[model samples]
Target: MSTKFPEIQGGGSLILAWQIKGKEVLVVAAGRIVNLLNADAKVTVVCPRNGLNEEVAYRVNNGQVKHVDRVFLPVDLEPEKKVAMVLTAIDDPDASTRIWKYCKQMKVPANIADVPSECDFYFGSVHRDGPLQIMVSTNGNGPRLAAAIRRQIGQMLPEGTGDSVKRVGQLRRKLRKVASGKTSRDISKRMAWMSEVCDKWSTDDFNDMDDEDMDKLVRYYESGEVPSFEEIRLGSRDHVVWEFDGTFGWM
Candidate 1:
């Protein structure tokens, strides 16, 4: 039977693939565990005295568990002693509930993979380009659909977009340094300067920038050379007003 669950709206860190690196994670299950070794999260897989641990021990190449135990001891629940994140992929619902409740009491974040009602967090579909990352979440309701949409969005992004992102970040740092050293206190002027720089930088211009081009552009911006107001007006497109009064209730 289908039931309607109340939707909770909140904002928190949308974890990226690289963010969990070097953190400790625990997976409790009886079968093959999906590999998380690439993320560099130290993973510990717990199972019964069966051969499940032995089978996994033979297959994995990197980030494999240093210790595979038959039971999770009570001492493991200590706030400072436990892993940062726990994932329960066990087939039993009752076991998942018990484990999740224990984790909650310990103030540890946990997820039951497909069992959203029992999870503190849901894994979202992620796409990455260097430092740039995009995450799509259906609030733990539709993971496969999220993955499909992520792939579509990934395909639409231009090649070398990550490089452009890096260049823009460098530009921002330069602008901030220049502002701190000499720019006026007027916040509006600073915003206008940013908009002008962004307005002149077209898609084609970004695509054409090689290492030499990027260096030159960086130097030009860092030199605190501002074009005349008339020149900026002539070169830039008119900014559009985004009216969200009707759409955003919070506004």
Candidate 2:
């Protein structure tokens, strides 16, 4: 056996989290507006009222999203509006193709829903928990499979992982304030120290941390001293233990 995996081909999509907050996003239909709304995207749906799904209709009526109340137009991508992205889910194939072409001509990114060939980007199956988001992408091959994998991964993750991440983020902010200086080396050292702390601590350990515990960590950072995980971990809780059978099963 060669014991080496063969090189894969044809999927070279670059995955990224598109920042759309406060930016205009034109959605051609109602199939996938909920995720946009969740991301705080300034969405404008270009579809008749009868075309909207129940949730979308409620959102439009509540003024949560702007509604055009008609079919999509080329003018929707007018230069002055500076549309950040377009997502078209309309049933008309010709109209979808036209919208995709217009987006390309206008140099705007677009996702022609369920039409991967026309999409500039494909939405991944995302596992969201507070400040933490884990996205699984299959390069437009299998969205349902990606979602299934996401669910499996989600189950494997320890509970309170999101809270741990949030706490770590807060600690990083506080550490930055404490270690603030003009030196690039200082920033590098702070980042390295944080990395070490994360590697040493488990999710449960982070969940057990309080303001006092975090303050102690900051003090250690300020003093240019690194504390062992045992030294900083609270005594109130027992350390989390993991056991594995060394076998993986598909859902």
Candidate 3:
């Protein structure tokens, strides 16, 4: 059976949770060590003994930094016991390659930060608006581009979008109960009818709905009867505009 992936919300939690599945992670880096701080697991930082900076070591609680002359992971550490491997030593191609090879041999999932070619996963840029979350991914091509796109989309969303989602959820539950035990054809017909009703929805309609208003709308759907307000509202909105054709006004 194929495994179904959940709708992932992009954030540090998602990345950290996936990496810390086994409660331990090995972070191999030479510099730029701050990125690994978010890993939820007990992290062991492996770096060049001579190349290790005091500041970097201090960030991971000093003693957590393992001083190794060369970038070589412990072969005896069972892959099943270790949840993940993160390589931030992207500048040294040879060391990164060796570490990646070792990770592959051990059957551990590895992420070579900023090096998409060597990475198995790509972190996405996320935008949050109340209960709504929008994530953008480049499939390892460009992360900054994804972030830029996320910002643009975030700007366009209305502030009341989260409230709209809640209202829609209520409508969905009511429809499901109304359509329960119906034939496939009958359900499809009801869905089509609801689609027409949705076409009539305005931003104001969503914004103004109270429990009583929602209950009335639900009754209209259950009975297959059009609401009287809809006819009057739609009919009163027509307007005529006049334009001048250079010298005279044309109707």
Candidate 4:
């Protein structure tokens, strides 16, 4: 007997974080312009002055984004501009469809807000804290449900989780510097050590670590020694007086 379940159709959208930094993005209307701006996209909103909501107006006035002060024309998608993507939230379905066709012809990605079929991608409800970002998507089924789930997940995450992530990143960079020129086996060992540290250490333990503690951890990596959590927290390796100059070694 075949063990495979019956196939389900639809919902095959791939979730991704598009890197639009410093790239031109043509926004047909003002509704989703803020999201584009937040991603560091060089946004140019092609909408009437009256169409702009308060927030968008503020951004335009502040010179955060360029404003065209007119409705979107097919000319806006001219090849020389090299638009990375397009986002439209206009009320006119015909105009939106026209823009979508132009985007397709130009091979540019687009999101036509509320019209999932026309969108090449859907925006997720994002929860951000410093370097840590969690995005929840419903694959264009129910945005509200996705937002609710994101809220619950955010509430469950421990406080200072972002700080812990930043700390771990610093530790990883330090370990790489200390383990420089080591063999492939040694590199694998260092990776294993980092994995162990992440598994064994709590968020509180990472948040509690300061620069001095990080230095000691690097020393442990250099010597192929692993210290207990309590030993690291209590500065048991303080007497060794470790310092990183060129590479981490006994000084």
Listed in order, each prediction's TM-score against the native is 0.62, 0.86, 0.47, 0.82
**1-251, model 1: which lDDT tens digit per residue?**
54598666575445545467777777776332443554667777776536354556653435466445566654665667558888777677877888888888888888876677777767678787865678888776677999999999989988877766776676666556655544464455556665676677754455554555544443445444544333333432355344576765673
Query: Which wins on TM-score, candidate 1 or candidate 4?
Result: 4
Quick one: best TM-score, which candidate? 2
Instruction: List pairs with backbone clashes in candidate 2.
Output: none
TM-score quality measure for candidate 4: 0.82
Score candidate 1 by TM-score against the native. Answer: 0.62
The window of 10 residues in a row where model 2 has the poorest summed lDDT is 234-243
* Cα shift from native, residue 174, model 1 (Å): 7.2
What are the lDDT scores of the predictions, listed in order?
0.64, 0.86, 0.61, 0.86
Compute the lDDT of residue 141 as modeled in candidate 2: 77
Quality of model 1 by C-alpha lDDT: 0.64
By lDDT, the candidates rank as: 2, 4, 1, 3
lDDT of 4 at 243: 64
Candidate 2: tens digits of C-alpha lDDT, residues 142-186: 889999999999999999999999999989998988888758998
- In candidate 2, residue 7 scores what lDDT? 66
lDDT of 3 at 218: 65
